[model samples]
Target: MPLTILQKAKKLFDQKKYSQVISLLEPNILQYRESFQFYLYLGLSCLHTGDAGGASSYFQRARQIKMRDPDLLTAQAALFLRRGETDQAVEYYLDALEYDPDHALAKKALQFIRKKGDKETFLNMAETGKITAFYPKPRRTSLHPAAVAAPLAVFILCASIFGIKAVSLSVGQETRADLSSISLQAIDLKNSVEAGGSYRYILTEKQVVQAFENSQRYFQSYRDNQAQVEINRILNSNASIAVRTKARLLMEYLSEPGFDTLKDNFSYATVIQDAYLYQDCWIRWKGMAANVSAPDDRFGFNFLVGYDTRSALEGIVPVSFDKPVFLDPSRPFELLAKIRIENGSLSLLGGGIYQSVSP
Candidate 1:
């Protein structure tokens, strides 16, 4: 009788023979086309063995089957961050947040990434229309021997060309109209306010200018750090080569930062609180901070000052402060908050500290 592969693999695994188990499972993982668990286990095995690249590949395979797992998403983001691919890390972090807005790890990862350096590369691409541009493809040109040999074929070919040309003209007109309509809709939507009143639909041109200004400051700081490192070489014999190398690597990485997708960031925020439920009652409410960043989209209530958590730390709630909403990419947004109970009676949470963005 043949010994079972799974039994042998298990025996190897139980004996702390990870290499043997991996060898046994590797064949099966390749042979079985539909086994997501195999890939998940393979990823774990690789991770245990310190093969980051192999682990990432296996985890990516697992992700194809379980696309929306926040835990896996966070793990992938961590891996990307370790590999010095912060842009990729931020992408996965955003993906993880999309699934679980309250995901603390993902939230922290995003905050950490944002603080590293401004993502100027991504923003510049957006500003230059590179990200959204559709390049014009040239039409193929050819002369067929059949066109000269057959009159009927030539007539048919000419008719087909005219038909295609007519269809192309019609499609071109429709496409232009569609593009124009979409552009107008985008402008309108950008001008609208979110349900949470926490964010405006469109970043004003002024906001874009401010973003560029901040990015320039970040770039200047990055370059200054580089210059200081170069100048210190003469007197810095005590500095380890590895430390200097690592610093140089970091500076290079920060030189070209990426940008968040402005379109995706403008979506309506989830509803966190219902005003009618706590009408005229001073109540302490708790929620995930990411959801509270822009609350105007979900409700029409005005922020009266004592409702904002502007001064609160990331991943922590400030039940005491009542401030208005503010959008700052350099900071972690306390998306979740609630009105505080003060004195005996309920008052409309009012504090002029926070102002809702314009629609």
Candidate 2:
């Protein structure tokens, strides 16, 4: 029944109550640390209040979190304009157009800049109310000046870094055989906009950054298991697909530790305490097989860990194997199996076994 901070902020911003917007959002910065919209709103308010330093700081923070936002770009352009940085303003507007060609503020700004971007003329225009036309309203999310970049533009952007074989051709001998021709290859520019405007807003951009950094640190420490947990956190999070894919790829060089070489060889008791922690970890457990069912290649049994010593039974864990092994219920064996936490139950997936009894 209550409006959230963002909803209240949006209402205040739309009403042109820029000071109130700043007042409402500044204190709650911690709550919305990862929120791009929050920073964007704050930046817009700061710019309007004539605090260029504050606006620049908020805008820079917003850009670090999400660079492709058109509204943020347009506001940044406005900030550059107020700071008397026409060149930078033009660049920001152009950058905004690249992401959103139909951006109204960017288009108007670019057009106005082209006509009156000169120092004295721009200053004269600023004296009048005409310059206000280029400023963007936070509520109005719209884009239209330059068309979306075609495959040709794509080739141009990539020309300096490396030659895209499919999109490049050598020109007539002009010293270094200047790459002149851009391939006519069609590149479908991805206009990715989420259909539903509502979002759950799970992990903040800051959290994602911290998690990724922690994972890299863990990886550098050679604690691949801990590193893997952090990596999986990012992979399984509600972060962007590109970010998740990047997280998945960051540990491509990670080497899985063997059961024998594992730094933390968790005991049955330790595993029993927290199965999820030891998940996927392989441990050599000593036990005897019970209810042995070996049919051809598949083997299934209940491993009675620590039952070898008739003094006490640690736990009975269900185990299964795809390899053929003539297991005897009467004889004791040491099982090296990977821990699996399935449906809140702990189980062992058999990898190998050392038999005390003859095979």
Candidate 3:
């Protein structure tokens, strides 16, 4: 009878009858507790049926056994994002991208984030009249008086038109890049956040797990690309593929949540706290010397979280000072965490409700 039920459920799941599959599997997942496949399929079914919380719980159990499957992580990420946990969604996208760059869903999501960010920036600039500040200046001197007058005027007009277009294009490109980078970095901050015990958000635990999984994928890809680059150098071969691959990997990581660069003795620590929620933090030492002209970075420092405000840390090593910042709990949503990187060290510090405190 159990086998018959599973067979029928599988048939329904294959037929895109997610609701039917969930109806059959949900009870079994709760009863059997031993069938990982049941949980996995149940999660998928719930996901397709638009049950975010249910899908997350089922996926968490499935993830315990199939930890390396990016598909599971990606599915969970989608649930988090759908639930408005943007930070977690960004993290899973990164993890999925790292493992499989050809993942169309993740690529599309990243593109969406970049486009949205650009639109917002453009709107802000328009609202603030920042775009109107740069006024055109006429040419000061022209070669030859009469002969240059007509031609010079024409040339100047053409140059003005070209310059304006170029400037607009440049700004658009830069804005899009910045938005993508910022979003990815924010997710990183979310993951680095230490869960103050309970998950506060709708899909907090699922998002956190996804973030960690994504970080693992990113680091692995980063190291692999680095290795390939080194091999190319040693072989004196064309390093284009290796360089491109590495750059692409970096871009994907930046698109995900919680991407950071930190300074240190030998090198900067490039850390990822968690890829999905962007909370778990890591640091790579960046061997940048202290600004000798300004007071040494030995005592006071400036700390920044993602692309947000820079808070001044007094009489202490700001890079090392990481604490959870609570978000307002009155609303239906919750903030996941805050990621801060200062000095030459990178770390993912925790804050927010959508987090996990290990048992």
Q: Report lDDT (Cα) of residue 190, candidate 3.
A: 44
Candidate 1 vs candidate 2: the TM-score winner is: 2
lDDT of 1 by residue, 96-155 (tens): 555555556666655545555245543453355442221111112211111112223322
Least accurate 10 contiguous residues by lDDT in model 3: 135-144
* Best by the TM-score measure: 2
Q: Residue 265 in candidate 1 has what lDDT?
A: 16
Ranking by TM-score: 2, 3, 1
Question: Could you say which candidate leads in lDDT?
Answer: 2
* Angstrom error at residue 359, model 1: 54
Clashes of 1: 30
Worst 10 residues of 1 by lDDT: 260-269
What order do candidates take by lDDT, descending?
Answer: 2, 3, 1
Please report, as a residue range, the 10-residue window in candidate 2 with the lowest summed lDDT: 182-191
- Per-residue lDDT of model 2, residues 30-102, tens digit only: 7887777888888878777766567766775675566667788888777657646787676566567566655
**Which lDDT values do the candidates have, in the order given?**
0.38, 0.64, 0.40
